[model samples]
Target chain A: MKLEEFKEREKRRKFLKEISVIAIGTAVGITTYLICLITHFDIFGWNFGLVLSPLFAGYAESFLAKKYLEESTGAVSAFILFIITVVWGFIISNPTLGFNIITAGSIIIIIQAAIPTATNYFLIGMTLAIISHISGIFKKITNFFYKRYLQLMGKLNLDPRIIREENAEEKYHFYETEPDMNHLGVLLLTLEYLPQGKELIDNKGIYEKREIFTFNQREELKSMRKNEMHLKLMASVKKTETKALYNLIKELKNDGCNAVLNLHMTFETLGQDKGENVRQIIVRGTGVVLADKTDS
Target chain B: MLLSSTSTLDNKKITKYHGLVNGEALLGTNVYKDLFSGIRDVVEGRTSTYAADVQNARDEAFKSMEAKAEALGANGIIGIKVSYNNLGGTMGNTILVTAYGTAVSYEK
Candidate 1:
């Protein structure tokens, strides 16, 4: 064969290899997205524009990886591509399906396939089946929980900010604000379920201790902590809390609340202290009031 | 010396502030570390409810910026910036993080 012809053949072979890698990656991504959609009924109700996001995202990601990694796109990269695809799929899907099951299944399959004695064909088939099955089940369960929670929230006259799927691997953090101070009273009215005050409220509608954080008390605490590390901490805390509060207020505005009367921050803390730092800060003025009137 | 491969004509210096580095590797050291820490915080319930989504947005931004830098052939990214915005009415939040730096080709 002529030297130029040989070079052309080599180039074509390299091109084919690159194309195959991209094609495989795209296939994995698309299949995962489809499985998630099939099991999640809420996803089907999403706007068409949102549904196409994962497809486009997957194609772009695969193309980019192929262009850059070329023949060196290792298994790790492929896995990362899979993760990226799943995340994008969740984002694009309506109601946002949690990826814990999908992620766990993918990891398990990858680990199994990495075993020296594992057969390639067996691994591939097993992984594909497991991924599809888990993805579908997770989507269905998540959708069921989400719908139930939303319905409950609607019935309670309480707006649910986020409806996270109940999964063993899933953790939730929520911050809410009481704009009219009326909600504060209501929260206190139902303090039986609250974390700190859960044990305080009895059937008689009485509490061991009625802790309230008024708007004025909050401002005073902020002023006191102005020069301390607590100030910075409070600033960051309030930023997120205020956001959650703002969103809640927007939802409740038509129902009558001019301003957020108070704010509540609930999060899980790490370490042996279970978030001692946060507890110390919030406990300082746990029941203080910030403002009185809705306009205030 | 048959120097047939020396095809250097006009090279432009592209300095990207907070551009991506590590070749095609996505996520700079600081950005990745910060992102993981944020994620950890969310997982640990140390953050507010929206922190997880915020962290995800931050991660996505880093990935996006890295992709852009890769397209530009950048060596390292510096001067990174991250910002957040909320799409009201239960749509959740959006985070925008940018990494930029100069793209340079070193001659050996």
Candidate 2:
């Protein structure tokens, strides 16, 4: 089989396996909930099976498979239990039709029950109003502390005085303000202003930001360190972390290395007249040339 | 010679083991530079002079380790670890950086 076809088949198999696992877990959870209802099981005036079956089933599946199940998979089991609860409530409310065998009238009754009632609308409206008011107050209170907390953490150096509305035409530098800004904001800003964005100064010169290397902190580091062969050591100190990493990658690529390992990066005060912060990135991975395996 | 901190090399078979190799570098700053660095540490929250010295020492140690591995007829070094120590005293004001790892020859 072709490589792409093989990979596609494998992916489909994996997806099917995951679905089966979730289905089994949900079935077990529902069975436990039914058993609890039939046995009248209760603990401390709470239905133990109803409350904990989904959680237990999800955990049990993960433990048995020797893997961490994603939160969505656990949610699937919980949602199934929720659907069972609704059906049980319907049977309790309309015992005559719900307990009876399937009929057109019973189907109609279920459809009617599924439709939102006037009381449901009122409850939803009140909940939304309460949530909006509470969230507005919460946002204001958190925004007040956010500046102070960031200052306490020594990450915020954004002086509002320096960013005057009158002098808003001047550029606002990210490096001078905060080393770690909202990464998504930086990405979007860069994308919005394309060719000139490489210089990192916007067209209007409003925000002057540096391109941050979007590397997976754990996964990329672990993979490169463990799997890549190293040939030469690459190290550089630049005005920005982006520059240092970018230069290191360029040098490594020039040396014919596909990956880097054992990276040690640090920020140090240059003690220059401007007291600029310089990033020192050292790559100690012995650069190795990956062999062409296709020929082999 | 290829040098890496990881214990193993990827996609390469070890043809020969050349045992362990090591390197050490000792560095000392001038008395005036040291004094200025100490003052700068108090005022600026960092001693750039000391930082530069440590960086130089680390590079020297790595270079020394690479030479030692080469001398042992090894083309690769694995499981490398670096350590830094300050030999403190009036006369013994020195910084020592040491690097050590296993040297091996791998398939080309």
Model 2 Cα lDDT, one tens digit per residue, A71-163:
234335545554554456335545333443343223322332354253245435544654655478666776688556546534422111111
| Cα lDDT of model 2 by residue, B29-95, tens digit | 3333344455447755555655776787687778766886787688987767777654322222444
User: Model-by-model lDDT, in order?
Assistant: 0.34, 0.45
Best candidate (score: TM-score): 2
Which stretches of candidate 1 lie above 4 Å from their native place?
A39-77, A94-102, A105-296, B1-108
Each candidate's DockQ: 0.01, 0.01
Instruction: Compare the candidates by lDDT and give the number of the best one.
Output: 2
lDDT of 1 by residue, A154-207 (tens): 564332122111110122222222233223222211111212212222222111
Cα error, candidate 2, residue B44 (Å): 9.8
Worst 10 residues of 2 chain A by lDDT: A228-237
Per-candidate clashes come to 27, 7
